[model samples]
Target chain A: MSKITSLADLKKKRDELKGGLDIRVKAIDPDSVVQVKVAMATCGIASGAKTVMEFFLEQLERRNIAAIVTQTGCMGYCYAEPTIEVKLPGQDPVVYGFVDLKRADQIIEKYIKTGELVDGIIPVNYQTIDFKE
Target chain B: MSKYSMHLLVCGGTGCHASESDAIVCNLRDELEAKGLMDTVQVILTGCFGFCEKGPIVKVMPDNTFYVQVKPEDAQTIIEEHVIKGRKVTRLLYQDPVSKEMISDSKHMGFFKKQLRIVLRNCGFINPENIDEYIARDGYQALGKVLSEMTPEQVIKEVRDSGQRGRGGGGFPTGLKWEIASKNKADQKYVVCNADEGDPGAFMDRSVLEGDPHSVLEAMAICGYSIGASHGLIYIRAEYPLAIARLKIAIKQARNMVCWAIRFSAQSTVLILNFAMEQEHLYAVKKQH
Candidate 1:
């Protein structure tokens, strides 16, 4: 690490370092940011969930979308090993099954950006107690 | 800024360390490695979270899940349930004493909700060991701004106008003190930071030093710039081993950044002397006295 010679250099250093802690900053009001949760159980990992998760983490930031990518247990879709659930602010979370890098990109560009429902969505088969009650 | 989507911040404060937070860190790393999710998740040992009563605390970022009293053995459960499944460990969540309801977020906690953190703003938030993390939070920006934009008189006036007072019980105006010190015409001047907390149960300074040592160092540098002192001395107690260790690391990193470097701003030479590092010199002074 070189010494910051001037104020401009310090500001540049700060900007370069900001991305490292961006997730924590966005997490403050999680309801306000795009929340992406990739299922990462044994079956999920076996089906390339790790790659899918990494793609979202890298792509969302690179694309300038405010998103929080996290890992979740099995979504009970073993057939779709690398399944992901994306919850946009003020909308119901949509679970997309068999999510590859291409599917994830489509989800971000189409479903996330334009709200156009893509083909791979796993319809909600079960309801929580909030719905049951 | 690596592609890590998740962050697990384990409290590395003395209080948490006593409860074996180091073992928790190791166990968490081992579990993450076993699951092959190491690249996706980043585990950082952070300073005090200020909730030492319920520590050792392990806070998960990007979701803001606060887990308290985290045991080393529970690392597997955190990785399996929280990190892997997106489900929070209810057993580890800080339950409200009154409602008995599990509070996952630290912001909503009864203890932290009402309090606004100023000086301790970056305490539990950033990795104290990593200078990049500190810089990410605008750590030395204040010093840079003061050095680049303001004159010594302007800096002192700004501090005075802000109604900033010394933390000491006397409530002395800090700007006035600086003015007084600056008026003294001497060949050599010294800005002394009193870090020796002798009052019983007073751990504020220690916490600040341990949690955010760079902030203290930056403030010292700012004071040096304001009072026209080329040399700064931090009179800290040897009892605070963790604070001392962190100060040494922070000083080294800041020196690398050139803010704490002997030639600060490339125009002035402000050397911050860590008294803990020069025990022999202090001993010599004491023997002479």
Candidate 2:
């Protein structure tokens, strides 16, 4: 939990996690932990994704919400700062926009815990073509 | 069918998030619960849908209706009209930037109409964390087929024939690189996925890792198999914490497949701001090629 200053230290930390770690880290089972992805690309950081990420980690830990919070790169939505993607098992993943600390707290409490959708959603302006087999 | 029948997918990509995608999600859930349809409607937050120009995107599954630039205030109407009554939110649908015509389906949309999405195949479609969704989309089938049906040489030949250049800036022939590494007489050769995608305006690698991480895993394993290497490394930057996390999940899922013992090493690469020198070197290399 200390500040990681060096690459060696980061590698060591990652190695420790990888060593003897259960494969359950991947959300294979539906009942497992929810995966929360925060966009931390340079654009996202400029828009305050770092703060949003920290908020999610802290809140999830404080509430014991057994979720995995991580960082991602530019989602090409530079207009929407501090974006986040949440994935629950056995369901689809959703992306939320314009996240501040307050909204982050709400997401954790309502959506992560109770499976309730909150405000701060970007309406779909772009269409994504999904190929299903 | 009455319970959890409707799935609401909200765009949580950075762009839409800045536009209040989170608030929209919260309000939508509140309205659903208030309408006593919480159990019947499952609201999920997903990654980017790739139409960044108009964000705060939302998609209704089974029907695949795209709603664009949705504000928190619009959440109630979306839930009331779309979820409750099963009507498309036409006003929120994406309109062509040029034609200004509301395009409901993504396939006909101009942004993605020309993109060939082999790498981005599973993105915006499946729950990234769910292995089943990935598997259902023939995600691991490529790996399984490569592992069981094709030999290292054959796999290398197929990739070489496919003309898939390294997505990395170098654009080197991927198969040739694998062949070089495979041909080298090293006791420990490595198949490294340059997830260290360091382009300024580029999120191609990041999206692949985030949305369809298994593809990268499959591709990396294929690289490993083709290169006669048992280990793989993803040189990702610490700056991309979400990509790292998703890559971590993907590596874990891939390891469970009972194929080769593929090891994942995630490391941060040095970022170069002005690629003037690199670009010069690239031109020189291209001339030789």
Candidate 3:
């Protein structure tokens, strides 16, 4: 670690460190950003969920998308491994199954970008109590 | 760069530490390891959450679920229910004392909703031990700004306009004091931070030092810049072991980042900090309101 001799150097260092805590910052107001949760249970991992999660994490930042990608346990969709749930700001969370890298890209570009409903969206199976009420 | 998807921040304040928050951290890590979610889910021991009455607190990020009074044994439940399933542990959430309502987010709580944190803003959020975490939250920007952009007069003027008073009772204007010191033409000038909160039940200074030590160091540097001082000293009591330990770590980390390094070749204000403990009884007696 070199000494930050000037204001520019300090600013540069700050920018570099900002990425590390981006997840924590975004967590403050998650309702305003795109939230991606990839199922990483044994079944999901066996079906290449890890790669799909990595793709989302990398591509979202590259595309300058305000998104957070988190890994979760099984969503009870064992048959459709590599499953992901994407929740756009001010919208219901949509779960997609059998997601490869190509499908992940589509989710980012189509569903996440333009809010256009795409293929491979699994219908909400379990009933969740609406906390908003 | 770590690709951690979720972060679990456990409080490591003196108050929370007494309640076995350290064990909670260990148990959470073990649980993550056992579930093979260690890589994705990051468990960090952060400073105080300021809600010590119900501590040890465990806050989940990217979701902002506030879990209060967490025990070491509850770590597995947190990992399984919150981290893995994305289901919040309702029983652990902060319940309103009056309404008996479980509040998931700390922002919504009445205790925090009315308060706007400035000095202790980063207290509960970041890991104080990590220099990068401090930098991420704009830690030494004030010192950088003072050194590069503002003159001593301008810095003094800004402080005056900000209306920040001395925390030590007398409520003296900080900027006036800095200007008075800066006017004195001395070969060597010193900036001293009085961290000796000798009063019983007064833990404000200790909390700041433990939770956000870098902030205090940066403030001292800014003060040194404004007052034409090259040397700095913090007068902290020896009783605050955690604060002292954290201050030592913060100083070392600042040195590694070259925060205390000489800015220019000439007129280098090499701000050196030393801890001083003396006359606790006199200070404590004087501090009594």
Which DockQ values do the candidates obtain, in the order shown?
A: 0.52, 0.02, 0.48
Mind giving the per-residue lDDT tens digits that candidate 1 earns over B1-289? 6677788899988899899999999999999999898987889998898999999999999889999999999999999888777788999999899877789999899898998889888887888888888888997888777766677799999999999999989999998999898888997777787888889998888888888888887787788777767667777777877887887788778777754333222112222553121334223323432
Q: Please tell me the interface RMSD, in Å, for model 2.
A: 18.1
Candidate 1: what's its TM-score on chain B?
0.89
Question: Highest DockQ, which number?
Answer: 1
Which ten contiguous residues of candidate 1 chain B have the minimum total lDDT?
A: B262-271
Separate clash counts for every candidate: 3, 57, 1
- Relative to the true structure, how large is the alpha-carbon lDDT of every model? 0.82, 0.66, 0.83
Over the stretch A1-82, how does candidate 2's per-residue lDDT look in tens digits? 2422223333343444431111122222223567787876777888888678767766775686656555556677888888
lDDT of 2 at B181: 81
Q: Write the per-residue lDDT of candidate 2 for residues B149-266, one digit (tens) a residue.
A: 5667998899899998966557999788878888888876656667666668898777777777777666766776677665566677776766667667666654553234234444
Clashing pairs in 3: A27-B62
When sorted by TM-score, best at the front, the candidate numbers are 1, 3, 2
Worst 10 residues of 3 chain B by lDDT: B262-271
Better of 1 and 2 by lDDT: 1
Off by over 4 Å in 3: A40-43, A73-82, A123-133, B259-289
